[model samples]
Structures are given as structure tokens and as C-alpha cells.
Target: MSFIRIGFPSLQQFCVNALVAVSLLVGGVAHAEGGPATAQDGERVIKLAAAADKDPLAVMSSAEGRWFQKWADDVSDYQFGPDKGVFWFHNGVAKGDLMRVLRFHHTVTTAAFQWQKKIKDPRLNPADDDAKTLAGVEGLLRAYEVLVAKNPENRVAKIDDLIAIRNKGGLADFVKAMPPMPSR
Candidate 1:
């Protein structure tokens, strides 16, 4: 076999092309409701992203968006990160709602992007992100409470269970009984 050496210019061009292809592939990596993002939903987000002063929450009304939020709540073990240190997709999946759904949309797509990009430049600072994280938890709680309070059909059981757990000992006890996050 003969060995062929590629010049620096050729190798650099190859690298650039490879990165573009990988980016396109990663664009479809996000999932919703146990399935991948629908093609129409993807197109809508692309359009919204290009629009000036567009509301990201508008995407939450999309088909994939609604499903993803529910999926985030349903799947306690759902996460995106490396083995040791990484971004937690739904660190507290217990609380959820329309607002939380929109927030999760922002987290997984616009803010975090793909897994590789999210890991490189995570939105939350591991060292000093406690306040923001706590704020987010509180926000989810409020959203969930409001959703449950409005006589939402599907949310009553979840809220009731949470209340029951809280009544038992508190959120602390409830969380202590939660299964550990699955390995990435």
C-alpha cells in the first residue's frame, strides 16, 4: 500500500468541512417525548431564531415542545452530560409546567445547543450557579403549582403525590428517596 500525505491546506479544508457536517448532525440530536424533534418543529425554531424580537416561548406551543416538557417531567433519569461533571438536563424533574417547558426549551436548544457545545461552555457555572439554579427551581415550583391549581386534568396526581411526599416528612425526605441520576 502506498501512503499519501495531505498538505496543510487540504487538511485544514477537510477539518472545516467535517465540523460543518458534524454541526448539522448535532442539530438533530435533541429529543422530545421519547422521540426526536419533528421536522416541522425544527423548521419553526429556525425561523423563530432568525426573526428579530421573537419570543422563544412561542416554540413551546409547538408539538415537539409540549411533548418535550412532559417528557422532562416523566423521565426522572433523563440527563445530558459526561460521567463526572456536566450539565444536568432536568436536575429537578419533579416541578414542571408551561413556563418550565419554555425554560427547558431554552436550556436544551438555544442556550445549551448540542451536547458537545453545552459541555464546553455550560450555561450554569458549577462553582457559583447556586443562586440561579435555586431561582430556577423556585420558578418551576411556582409554575407547577399554578398549573395544578387551575384544575389541570393530567397534573393533579403529580401535585397530589408531591404534597403527600411533603406531608410525610418534606421535600428533603422525598428527594432522599429519589433514585440516583443515571450515569451518562
Candidate 2:
């Protein structure tokens, strides 16, 4: 059998492309149409966040706009970075009217995302393992729904539950245990 030989440069490019594809898939940044993300795509998310009753502009400006820049770069490759753009996205799993939902969104964007990207501990870094980030996001989304179903006013309990679940490494199980979001 004859084997095909590839050059190092070709292999490196292939690896880079493969990594980009995998990251897009896992990062939830890929468009539904399977094309490279664009400024409009990022803008759409920002609009959705604004409609969700959260201040996208404010979040964009928070923490000296550090996280905001990273999130924008993730989706738009800095074509419209936080310095020049405001962006946010609600997955429609949580109600924006609920204070708990709003707070959770803020926490996820500012705190959770930071930890997931930076922390070495698996317990703190949801992105440490394959699919863990998705699981964590889904868990938080479901938790928002559960809290909305019960009481939207109390945010302390919501925060406590999040901390408890993260500490216990139970995000996937927590997602399974949550009641389904009511159909609109």
C-alpha cells in the first residue's frame, strides 16, 4: 500500500483549521447556517440581550470592558470588538423579566466565563473538559427557569444554588433534575 506524505506547513494549517472548527462547534459561536460568524451575527446577539431587559451597553462597559472584549472577539473576531460594539445573547431558555435570570446572565458573562476560561481547577473551569461548558450553561439556564417558576425576587438562593452545584461538580445532574421550562 502507498502512503500519502504531507508537509509540516500543510499539516500545521490543517491542524489550525480543525481546531477552529472544533472550537466553533463547542463554543456555540458557529452560525446555524454553518458559515463563519460575522458582525451582524454578533449584533443580533446584542439586540437579543437588550430585548431580554438586560443592559448590554452597561455589561459591555463593566470590568473595564475586559470580558466584553473577549466575548465579542469570540463571536466576531474583533470585527466589532467591545470597544466598538455591545453584545449579549439570551438563549431563550430563561426569562429576562425575572431578576434572578438577569442576575444569572450577568454572573455567567462576567464571573463564570472568566473562571471557565482561566481557572485550572475542573470544578471552577467548566471548559476544562469536553462538553462541560455546554452542560454548565444548560444547568444555569434550567436553574433560571426553575427559579422563575418559583420566585423571581430572591436572587440569594439562586446564587447559593449555583455555587453549591459547581462545588459538587453536579452541573450535568442538576440539568437533568431541573423541571422543564413551561411552554409559551
Roughly what TM-score does model 2 have, to 2 decimal places?
A: 0.28
Candidate 1, superposed: residue stretches over 4 Å from native = 1-138, 167-169
lDDT by residue (tens digit), candidate 2, 1-184: 3211112234654564445434433444334332344544444443333322222222332332333344444532222211000111233322334433443344333233323344323333323432333333543444444443344442445445655776688855654444433344
lDDT for model 1, please. Answer: 0.37
Off by over 4 Å in 2: 1-57, 60-155
Global lDDT scores for all candidate models: 0.37, 0.37
* Every model's TM-score: 0.30, 0.28
RMSD of 1: 18.7
**Scored by Cα lDDT, where does model 2 land?**
0.37
Tell me how many clashing residue pairs each candidate has.
0, 0
The TM-score leader among the candidates is 1
